[model samples]
Structure formats: structure tokens, C-alpha cells
Target: MLSRRSVAVATMFLGIIYLAFISLGIPDSLLGSAWPVIRPDMGASFGFAGILSMVVAGGTIVSSLVSGSLVQRLGTGKITLISCCLTAGALLGFSMAPSIFWLVLLAIPLGLGGGAIDAALNHYVAENYKAHHMNWLHCFWGVGATLGPIIMSFYMVKHNSWRDGYTAVSMIQFTLAIVLLVTLPLWKRIAVSREHERLDSMIPQDQVGPELKQPAISSKANVLQIKGVKQTLIAFLFYCGVESTVGLWGTSYLVGARNMTAETAAGWISLYYGGITMGRLITGFITLKINNRVLIRCGQIIAIAGGGMLLLPLPQLFLVGLILIGLGLAPIYPGLLHETPTRFGRDNSAKLMGYQMAVAYTGTTFLPPLFGLLAAQTTIHAFPFIVIAFIILMMMSAEKVNHILNNQTKSTGINC
Candidate 1:
């Protein structure tokens, strides 16, 4: 527990984390909204999205895999501040890019910056904050996510310029970086406090032999050795695919398959993210009385129902489906993350989280384009059905993970 003075410092840093999370969202949603306009201006084909996305994903995967080492070396404070500044710089590059080449070139920093901050903050929050803050932290991200499209829409509607949206977001990110720099000391204090706790909790030398003192495996390697890790990884991977596919294709499916207008579809698409944000806002209250496992199970059922809605011939259900899907998706990611530290010991959780993010982003990186190919070969109507398939797979993976962890909890008398 924090002393009164450390508590005050933690409070300040928590506020800073919220801002950094917001900063994370600002650039993330900007691309999807602006791409419709950007694609045409850059003279790129429809398939160009895969290229750019692949590049970004590649960068994200690289940074996410190495995030553990980076955090150990640079500390979360320096990593967060530096990554935000890099992302801000990349955003500025995006605003000024005259061609698709420049955009592709800039994707490197954008992805790296985004990945590093994401892995670090997620571990930081899970290790330090309460379950409710995990939900709320993501809620703030949803707010930024929701705002990004709205900002782009305003510029698109008014000046027909997407550049202004990027510029505005860049300024916000830059401001956050400076704020983080000012609050650097808080990160140091909390980090030092965490290290002391870790050391003090270790076994005394008298209790264990030297041969048994050190782990046979590396910390990073031990992540995979955890009993339920495979199932957990699969759950996370499918979850990312399901969530990303729904968000990315919802607009195209509405416009092409349902014959909705682009403007209307864009507006409707925002409902998905809005539902996610709203759901987290509500989940914060509910989790006070419920366990993360129960909440996750409930979310999966709701998501399946939402996916079922999309399979109908009726077009109006699309919006409702998207909203429900968002709500269902809202709790899963954060809840799983919140469970990590306790499920696998705190020391191992950091590397596990980094690997989780890497795999999750890998799903995000590849699935949509594969879905795109599916849509191309079949029909746009396949979108909802494909989403349904992913949901089912995710549910199955989740069940396996539940079984594995529950058995461990029972046999070992440990609460996962």
C-alpha cells in the first residue's frame, strides 16, 4: 500500500496514464476515418491497405516482442514519454506526407511507438491499479477513439482535408508527451516501490538450495511454460481478430452489402466504438461485485448474440449488431489483462503480457486482410458470418482457457 505522500504521487501519475491512454487513441482511429479520403489522393488501389497495414503490424510485433527488455532497461516512465513523442512525430509526418510512400515510410515509427507504449502501460496498470481502473483506462481510450473519427469527419465534411485531423491529433499527443516528461519523477517513485516489494517477497537463502534458487528457464521463456498459456494466447488471438474484423469491415459491409451511404455508414460505424466505451463505463460498476471470469463469460455470450444479429437479412440490424458486438468486446480485453498478474505471478506477468500483446497484434495485423480476400472471393454478405465464425472460435478458446485455469486453481489451491 502507498503512504499518504506516495498515494498523492500515484494519483497524479494515474491521471497522467489516463492522458497517455487518450493520446494512444487519438492516432489509432484517425487512419480508418481518413483512409477513405487518403487512398484516392495517394492514387493507391483498394489492396493498398494491406500493404500499409502489414508494415505497421510488422513494426508493432517487433516492438511488442522486445517491450519487456525495453521496460527493464529504460523503465516505463522513459518508455512511455519517448514512445508518445515518437508517435507524435510520426503523426506530423503523416499530416505532411504527399504520397503513399511517405505514409508507408512513416508507419515504422507509428507502429513502434504505439506498440512500446501499449505493452508498457498495460503491464504497468495491471501490476499497480485496481480492476476498475483497467476498465476505465480503456474507456478513456474509447473516448479518444470515438473522437478521432469525429475529428476527421468534421474536417472531411468542412474542408475536405484529412490533414487537419492528423495535425490536431499530433498536437494533443505532443502535449501529452510534455506532461509525461514533467511527471517523470512519479514513474520513478512507483517503479522503485514495486522493485522493493518484489525483492522483499522473495524466499530467504536458508529456505532454498543454490541449485534450486534460480529458475531453469528464462523469465521470457517461462511465460509459455505456464499451464494455461496456450489457451490464453489462443483466446487473446481470436479475440483481437473478432474485434478488429468487426470494427474494420463494418463500414464497408454497410455501404456495399447493405447499400447504405458512406456518410451514414461512417456515422453508424462509430456506434461500435461508442458501445465499447459505454460498456466499459458500465462494467466499471458491475465488476465491483463480480469476478473477471464471470464477466468475461457473460461478455462472450452477449457478443455471440450480437454476431447472430448480423447474420439476418434485415439491414437495420447491422447497427444493433455492431453496437452489441462492441459492448461484448469491451470487457474481454481489459478483463483478461486484469487477470494476468494474479493468474501467473507478477514477475512472469510482464513478459506474458508482452507476448500477449504481440500475438494479439499479430491477429489484428493479418486477419482483416484475410477477411478482405474472403469478401472478394465470396461476397460482402459474408462479413457477419465470418465474424460469427471468429466469435465461435474465440468462445471455444476461452472455454478451454477457463477449464485449464480452473483446474489449476482447484488442484493447486491458487486463485487464477
Candidate 2:
């Protein structure tokens, strides 16, 4: 039996996992900050930078699939351990790479580890933790993401070297890896409980003993086969596109097109991420009363408004717009994830999340490169329009999804 204290300890361990991988965002945040330093050091072109991000994104998509399989084979606890080590190794490699090609090569492990950590942790949290816990779990991700750039920016200002900043962040990840390893025993206990629950759920309820009434057989089937899975996946994909496109490209647009200073651009970027953090925290509370579909639709509108603000000529209003955008996007990811197991059943939650993440990472991988290519050709100002287009598509898809889910609820007489 897993004690409440044990579960709390496991939650802390998972929070450390979020902290570990969330630090990965530091590299990206540093890219803009260190552009001048790194470009001269590595002789990188804009196309090369785009390719590097593309490589990471591509690797993440593939690795998400691989990690999903690993989780199935090794279990979430073991997979998380492997992922932590891989992430540590990748960051260490990235910190020391002498050339851009070497850095790009290192991106493979980084993606694998990052994607694995994300999928496994998300699965664990969704399975072991309650619904409110899911919100706070993702909130930690937001916190780590927000801290990444700040840490990088602080180190860059102090050391005047991007390498040092990366190396420091690498150390932090290494420390997290050690912490995760130390907590492995407790995780194993939780895993056993989860598996037992799974076994119990698979047996017929009438045949089940009183102790096994609450079974854990969360089905691992693809969302398409499940009644509500298809609609959830569709909403999830569009949400991923909108969230990633904006997160990756917004800073570039501010600096390159609007000609803002590095400091101002960084502050704006902070606002964008901070808004996400705030939204997640608030949504964690508000979700108790509100339907997720309603929350998601409201988020879509807010994202559209934020994108619109950036598209306009008012530079002064950009920060206000970004906050709205962040707030809007904040709920979509966690909402969709929380709804997944509920819609599809818990047996296959990890696999479903893996596929969901793979497709979503695919969006993150491709769309950013497309935005970069567009910026290279026309102007960074055009990037917001791309975001707008995606947001519109996401909203339409979400509306359709809401309709489908509602009809399914009526047909099956399921409350969700």
C-alpha cells in the first residue's frame, strides 16, 4: 500500500522531474540572448538556427513514440530514471560542444530525454495524482519554463558567455537527475499500486472482490477507437499548434520586427511565460466549478485577442496582448490532458498521451521552422499572422470537438 506521505514524496519527486526538464527551455531562451555571442562563436546562419530547432523538435516527436514504448516495457519509474540520465548527458554534451554540428547532434539525446521525461511524468501525474494535482503539476512546468530564461539571462549578464550559462543550467539538471534516482524506491511502490488497480479494473465488476471494487484498468487504446478520444485529440493538436507557435516565435517577432531592445524583448518573453504560469495556477482553482470545454473555448478567444494585439501597430500595447495570449493558452494543455484518461479510460493513458505528445511535438517542430522561414523571407511581423491563423483553426476544431463530446455524453449517458 502506498501511504499518503509516500505519495507526497512521489509528487515531490515528479516536481523535481518537471524542474529538471523545464530547465531545457533555458537553451531556447538563451538563443536570443546569446545570438550575438553564439553566432560569432559557431558561425551560425538563421537557416542553421532554424534547422537546429527543427532537429530538436523532430527528435522530440520521434522520441515521444520511443519513450512511450519504453514506459510500456520498463514502467514509468524506470523510464523516468533513464530519461533523467539521458537528459543530463545531453545537456552536458550541449554545454561542451565545440561546433554547431556537435550541438545539433546533441539535440537528439536532449529531445529523447526531454520527450521521455514529459510523457512519463505526465502519465504518472495523470494516473496517480488527482485532477487538481494535475493542474499544479503542469504549473510547475510553467514555473520551470519561466525560470529558465531568467536564470540564463542572469548568468549571461554576469559571465558574458552563453556557454557558462548553459553549463550552470546543466549542473542544475544533473542535480535533479541525482534527486530522481534517490526517490526511485518510493516510485516503485506507487507503480505497483497503479498496476494492481489496472489489473482489478480488467476483471468483471461482479466477479471482483470487495477490496478490488476500484480497479485500475485504464485502457491503452488510441483515442480514435474510443468514443470521446477523437474529439479530445483534435482539440489537443490545435491547442499544441497555437501554444508552441506563439511561445517559440513571439520573442523573435518582438526583437527582429519591432526592433525592441534585448532587455525589453526578454521582459516581454517573461510576461508571456509568466502569464502561462498565472493562468495554470488560477485555472487549477477555477476548474473545480467550470466545464473544461467552456474554459478551453474562452482560452481560444483570449489567445486570438493576444495575437491580434501583436499584429497591430501599437508597440506599447504588446505586453498587454502577450499576457492575454499566455492566459488564454494556459488552460488548453492541462485541460486536454486531464480530459484524456477520463474520455479514453486510464488503461492506455500513457500511450494516448504519448501519441498526443508526438503529434503535438510534430506541430512544435514544423511550425516554428515555417515561421522562421517566413521571417527570413518577409519579416518577423508576419509571424503573428501565422499564430492568428493557427488560433482560428484551433478554435473551429475545438468547437466541433465540444459538439462531439456533448453528443457522446448524451448517447452514452456518461456525465463527462
Q: Write the per-residue lDDT of candidate 1 for residues 86-189, one digit (tens) a residue.
A: 89999999999999999999999999999999999998998877788899999998888778889889988888789988888889889898888888877878
Task: Give Cα distance to truth, residue 409, candidate 2, Å.
Answer: 2.7
Q: Candidate 2: lDDT of 225?
A: 76
Q: In model 2, how large is the Cα lDDT of residue 67?
A: 65
Task: Give Cα distance to truth, residue 258, candidate 1, Å.
Answer: 4.3
**Candidate number with greatest lDDT:** 1
Off by over 4 Å in 2: 1-11, 14-18, 24-32, 153-160, 191-223, 227-231, 248-266, 308-319, 372-385, 413-416
- For model 1, where is the 10-residue window of minimal lDDT? 209-218
249-365 per-residue lDDT for model 2 (tens digits): 777778888888877887887788788888988988887777566677888889999888887788777668888989999888877777666555676677888887887887766
* Alpha-carbon TM-score of each model against the true structure: 0.87, 0.82
Kindly report which residue stretches of model 1 are placed more than 4 angstroms away from their true locations once superposed. 36-43, 153-161, 191-220, 255-262, 313-318, 413-416
The CA-based lDDT of model 2 is what? 0.72
